[model samples]
Structure formats: C-alpha cells, structure tokens
Target: MPDKDAGTPRVFLIRHGETEWTKSGQYTGRSDIPLTENGEKQVISSARLVVGPGKIINPSKITQLFISPRKRALRTYELLFDEAARHKFEGKVEITEDIREWDYGLYEGILPSEAKAGRKERGLDKGRPWNIWIDGCEEGESPKDIAGRLDRVIAKIREIQGPYMHGEKPVDVVIVAHGQILRAFARRWLGFEIGVKLPMMLEPGAVGVLSYEHHNVDEPAFLLGVNMAESEE
Candidate 1:
C-alpha cells in the first residue's frame, strides 16, 4: 500500500544557468541572450545531482513544465533533462511569457548600480534608493503587473494538483525561468504581496521547491530543505 501523503503535489522552480549578463550582474530582461559555455555545464551537472529516478526532482514524476520563452531559459531546460527523460512528459511542456524575467525596460541590460544612479538622477526615488520591488522600472511591468500574470500561473497549478492531492500517485510540476521572476513566483505561491521588500534570492542554476503543507492546498509553503534520494545503482 502507498503512503497516503505521497500524493501531495509539488512545484519545482528552476532559474536558468548563467549567461554573460548574469555573470556581470546586469539586469537581463527580454534580451534573448544564450547561456555561456559554463552555464551549459552548470545545468548538466545539476541534472546529474538533482534530476533522475529517486532524486529530488524525479523527472518521471513531473507531469507539467512551465518555461519562459527566453532562449537562455529554453536552453537550460534542454540541458536539464536529456531526450529520453523529457519524453516522460512530452506534451506537458509549456513555453509562456508569464514566466519570463521581470521586464527592466529602460534599465534592461544595465547593472543594478547603474539603474539606481539613473533613477536618482531622474529624481525618481526621492527619499530612498530605487528598489524594483517597490519603485519598479520606469517603463516596465510593475509589481502589480507581475502579480497578475503569476497569479494566473498559480491558479493553473492548483487546479492541476487539486485532483491528485490525496490519490496514490505523484504529481510534480516544473518551472524554468529567470531569477527575479522565479523568486517572485515563489513569493506569490505563498500568497505574499510582491510590492514589499522580501529578502529572497535564487541564483543562476539553482532550484527551489514549493508545496502544500499537510496535503492541504489552502496551506502552501516552501520546502526549505529536503533530503536527496540516494542515486540508483
């Protein structure tokens, strides 16, 4: 007999591997840059460690995948799972704009320091330094805009996971995207407002996990630490 709690579904959030802009601390949004050679290597190594049968992210259990349309993110997904592994969820992959990086607009391709200086020169931040969470980009999507789209994605995830929460099967969803957006997605997954300062970070090639507490869909929470399954012989 299967453990009744085993059916609780989970969402795996993955940030794409490093790019030149990422390595240089630039705000890369909508730039469509490909991953660096090291970035490809990073994803491949990560797959070996965390993705496979019995691993933290068992590819066989993943029923759906939400990916950003950016090439870097697309490439990360390509490297994260090989052809045979991806075949396990052939038609479950969705490439969507909703998961793309937060649009930096005038600040795109610039470093955070440069953005802050620009905002200060423009007399925008007035009393405080420019924080994307609160002040958002001048011509880009605001916190409200981000919440709107992420909310849609979160709704779809809940709808899919609801039916199998108490069943005997496993249902895991995967998301591949950029840093800021994935972090924001996790924040929204727990019903938090993104307009306030949240000291969260997801590095390039990193992964985070979110799931319901005690198999209750109404009680979403982050899995801070999970023991990795031993590699199969």
Candidate 2:
C-alpha cells in the first residue's frame, strides 16, 4: 500500500529555552540574552523526546531551518541537535532576523505591568490597558510591521513546500525562534490578523506543529496535540 502521509509537508515551530528575563516575565526583545542552565536542560530533554527517526521531528527529513538571530534562540538550536544531527542539515540552515523576537523597544527588560504603567504615565492608552497585540511599544514595531516580515517568511516556506507537496519526498521545515514571534507566525500561517487577540501560548523549550489537512497546501492547520515517543535509554 502507498504511504498516506506522503507529499504533505510539516513545519515544526520551536520556542527557544528560558532566559533570566523569561523567568522574570520581562520583555526580552533584541537583548541577546543567553539561556539559563535550566533552560539548556529543558531543550536537551525536549530534543530527546521529540527528535530522531520515527519521531515528531526527524532530523533526516528536515529540508530547511530558519533560526532567530538572538543568542538564546541560537543556544536552543545547538542543544536540540548534536554534531551528527547538525550534519544532516548542512546547507539548509539559515540565521535570519525575520524570525527574531518582537521589538519591544522601550518595554524591553520590563514586566507587562511596568509597561502598562509607563504607557499610562505617558498619556497613552488612557482608558484601556496596554495590549502588545494592538497598542505595540513606544519606538517599537507595530502589528503591521510584524505582519509584513512574517508574511515574507510564510511566503518563502510556501514556495519551498509547493513543489514537494505532491511528491513522495519529505519537505519538513523547522524554525527555532522566540515565543511571541512564533505565536504570531502561527497566527499568520492561518491567515489571521496580527492585531486580533488569539488565545495561543508557547512556553520556553516547547514545540508546535503546523501542517495542511488532506495533503492540501491550501488547508493550513495546527496539530493541536501529538503523542511523544519514549526517550531512548
């Protein structure tokens, strides 16, 4: 019998592991923080659970990898794949700013409550609270700015997967990036407006899958859950 899962491609969206700012609930855009010790442990454990042959993220099948420019995200990528696994994607990896975290601007290194208070004190968002999705940050990127860049990334992914969708070859793509940007990418993957609040969240050192339904690239959908493979002894 023919393989039922042929042709359809999968995109693995991975959020980088924790930093001190992430632990403290601070906005960590463009700060280039390194992962905490616990953060490295988290990604190492996650790699063992989700990556390998016959696993959710099989390295041999991956065709492309887009990584954020931040050090924390780069560290997560290093921990997720060993030297042997890295050789599998020799010419396919890209370190792009397009996948970097949202530019939090003046809100960088501050908590949400602090950001809100600052905005209020500045005579901004007078009646309502500050929502990053809608209001954005001072001297930072707006929803439109984010959408423009992410849309380009999405287009590139689609272009890469288009020719392989009906073939027997695997066109799995991987993205290693920050939490907020990955969430936004998911929203845009399904043609959602960035300004609209979506109840989506990605914790540090976690992975989410995006794929099409019925082997049709036009039908983009999220894999809400998947059973993980047991770790090797």
Q: Rate the local accuracy (lDDT) of all candidates.
A: 0.87, 0.87
Among residues 3 or more apart in sequence or in different chains, the pairs in candidate 2 whose N, CA or C atoms overlap within 3 Å are: none
> How well is each residue in 59-142 modelled by candidate 1, as lDDT tens digits?
877889999999999999999998998777789999999999999999999999998888878878777767788767889989
TM-score of each: 0.94, 0.94
Task: Work out candidate 1's RMSD over C-alphas.
Answer: 2.4
lDDT of 2 at 48: 91
Residue ranges of candidate 1 with Cα displaced over 4 Å: 1-6, 230-233
Q: What is the lDDT of residue 164 in candidate 2?
A: 75
Residue 186, model 1: lDDT of 83
Q: Write the per-residue lDDT of candidate 2 for residues 1-233, one digit (tens) a residue.
A: 86454457889999999899989999999898999999999999999989997787888778899999899998999999988989878899999999999999999999999988888888898777777887777999898889999999999999888777765677889999999999989999999998777888888999999988777778888977665752122
